[model samples]
Target: MAAIQWTDVAQRLKWEATPEGYDRIRTVWLKHCDTELRQDMEGLLSTLTDDCVYTVLRTTATGATRQRWDGQEGARAFYTALFQAFPDQNWQPEAVVMGPQGVFSAVVLNARQVAPWAGIAPTGQTVSIRMFVYFIWAPDKGKFGGEVVYIAPIAE
Candidate 1:
C-alpha cells in the first residue's frame, strides 16, 4: 500500500499538524469513524486500541442529554448496550463532511426507529436527525480521542 500522509489529512480536515512518527494517525481516525458510522460495530470494536478513548454526546429520549463512553472498553460496552437496548435500531450517516482536525465539513445523520428507542414504543417514525460532530485526532495515540457535538436539535 502507498504511504499514508497524516499531515495532508489533518490540513484538509483543518485540524492541527503533528511531528513525524504520527503520520498514521489520520488512517486510524478515518477507519474508526467509518466503521462505526457504517454500523459495523464488530469492525469498530476490533480497531479500538486498548488505551483508546472515545466519547459520544447525544440527546436521548425523555429529554435527557447524555455523554457515553469514556474509553475504548467504555465505547465498546456502550455500543453493545445500545444495540441490545434498541434491539431494532438502525442509525445511518446520511452525509459527512471533512472538517478541521479530523472533524466533518458537514454531518447529517439520519436514524430510523426500527424498534423501541426509549420508553416510547416503536413509532416507526423513521425520523431524520441532523447533527455535526467536531473531531479531535491525536496522531501519537493513533486515534480520534475526542469528538464534540457541533450541532443537534430537539424534536420539532
Candidate 2:
C-alpha cells in the first residue's frame, strides 16, 4: 500500500490555540459524540495535525482493547461510525491530565441502545460501561502521542 502523504493529517490539525478555532474544535468533538447533539462531524481532518496519531484505550473488568489510528482518515472513520452506531452515547470526563509532553483524559462511556451497533439493535437494552480514557497529545508535533483505555461494567 502507498504511504499516506505527510500533508494529509498534518496541515489540518494545527496546535496554535485560537480562542475561536479551538472552541470550534471542542464543540465539534462534543456535539459529534453527544447523543443529544447528534450532529454530523465535518472537517475532522483539520481537528488534528497530519503527524498526529489518534488512539483509544478500551478496558473492561475482564480485559482491555488498545487501538491507535493510522491518520486523519482512521480517526475520522472511527469517530463517525462510533457516534452513528451508538446515538445515545455519553461521556463524563473528570478532567484533562496534562503531562510534560502530552495530555491525559479520564472518561466514563455511557452507551445506550438506540440503534444497531454491529448488527445489534436496541432491544430496549442498555449498558453503562465505566472506562478511563487517556489521551497523550503533543503541542509541538500537533498530534496525539498515544492513549490508554480501561473499562468496567457499571450498573445503572
Candidate 3:
C-alpha cells in the first residue's frame, strides 16, 4: 500500500511523528485499512489479536447504548456483515493520535446502504458518517486488544 495523505488537521498536527510506537502501530493500522478496502477478511483479521473485541457506541433520544462483539468469531461476523452491506465502504481519516499504549482517530466513513444496517432498511444512499475510533494496543503482544468506536452520522 502507498502512503496515505490524511486530512489537513493531521498534517498540521504533524501526526507523521510523535508517539514512541507510532511507526509500528501505524504500519499495522494501515495494513488493516488496506485489507478492509480490498474486502479481505483474512488479511484484516490478521491485524487483530485472537480474542479481539469490537464495540460500537451510540447515542439515542433515550440515552446512550453500546453493541459489542466478542472474540474472533464475533469480529468475523461483525466485519463480514459490514462488508456485505457496504461493498464500497471507505474511510477518510481526519486525525490520528498514536501512543505507546493505544491509538485514537477521527474519520469520515463513506458507504452506500445496499443492505440493512442495524435493522435499518437499505436506502441505497451514499452516506458519510463521522466517527471516533480507539484501538487498545497490547504492546507486549504487539497486537491490538480491541476496538471501541463512537459513531456519529453526518447530516447532509
Candidate 4:
C-alpha cells in the first residue's frame, strides 16, 4: 500500500496543542473508549461537546475514503454503524501524544468480520487495523471538540 498522506490531512485540520493539555485530554479519551466498549452511548456522548465533529479518513494504494459526523446524533450513528460492522470490536491504544496542534493516538482495532463493513461482505475472519486519531480539546465544555481518525490495514 502507498504511504498515508498525513501531511495533506494535517494541512486541512491545522493540528496543534500543548503537552499538558494533551495529557489531560488523553485521560478523557481513554474514558470515552472505555464507555464505547461498554456500549454505553450516553456515557460516551458525555465525553464530547454538543457540537463535536468526528471524521474518518481511510487511505490505501487504490484510493482514499472520508466520512464525517456533525454532532451528538452523528456520533451515535457512526458508532452504531461501527458496532454493527464489528460486534466484538476491541480498541487498544498503542501510543498517544499531544502536539501543538492536537492530541494524536495510535490505536489497534481487533475484531471479527461478522457483519458487512464498508459494503464488503462478512468473511468471519479476524481482522486488525491501526488507526491514528487526532482530537481537538474543548476546555470550556471539558470535552473534545472534534476527532479525526485515520485508518489503515495492518501489514501481514
Give the winner by lDDT: 4
Name the candidate, 1 or 4, with the larger TM-score value.
4
Off by over 4 Å in 1: 1-26, 58-64, 81-100, 115-122, 154-156
Q: Which stretches of candidate 4 lie over 4 Å from their true place?
A: 1-24, 99-102, 118-121
The lDDT per prediction is 0.52, 0.50, 0.74, 0.76
For candidate 2, the C-alpha RMSD (Å) to the true structure equals 7.6
Which lDDT tens digits does candidate 4 get at residues 1-156? 012367755663564555666676777887887898988889898888888888888888888887788888988887788788788887888998765444678989888878765434577887887889877666657687778888887888
lDDT of 3 by residue, 28-59 (tens): 88888788789898988888888788888866
lDDT of 3 at 40: 90
The lDDT, on a scale of 0 to 1, for candidate 4 is: 0.76
Worst 10 residues of 4 by lDDT: 1-10
Residue range with the least summed lDDT across 10 consecutive positions in model 1: 97-106
Cα RMSD, each candidate = 8.0, 7.6, 8.1, 5.1
TM-score of each: 0.56, 0.55, 0.80, 0.78
The C-alpha stretches of model 3 lying farther than 4 A from their native spots are: 1-20, 118-120
Model 2: per-residue Cα lDDT at residue 12 = 32
Q: Over all chains combined, what TM-score does candidate 1 have?
A: 0.56
Error of 4 at 48 (Å): 0.8
Total clashes for model 2: 7
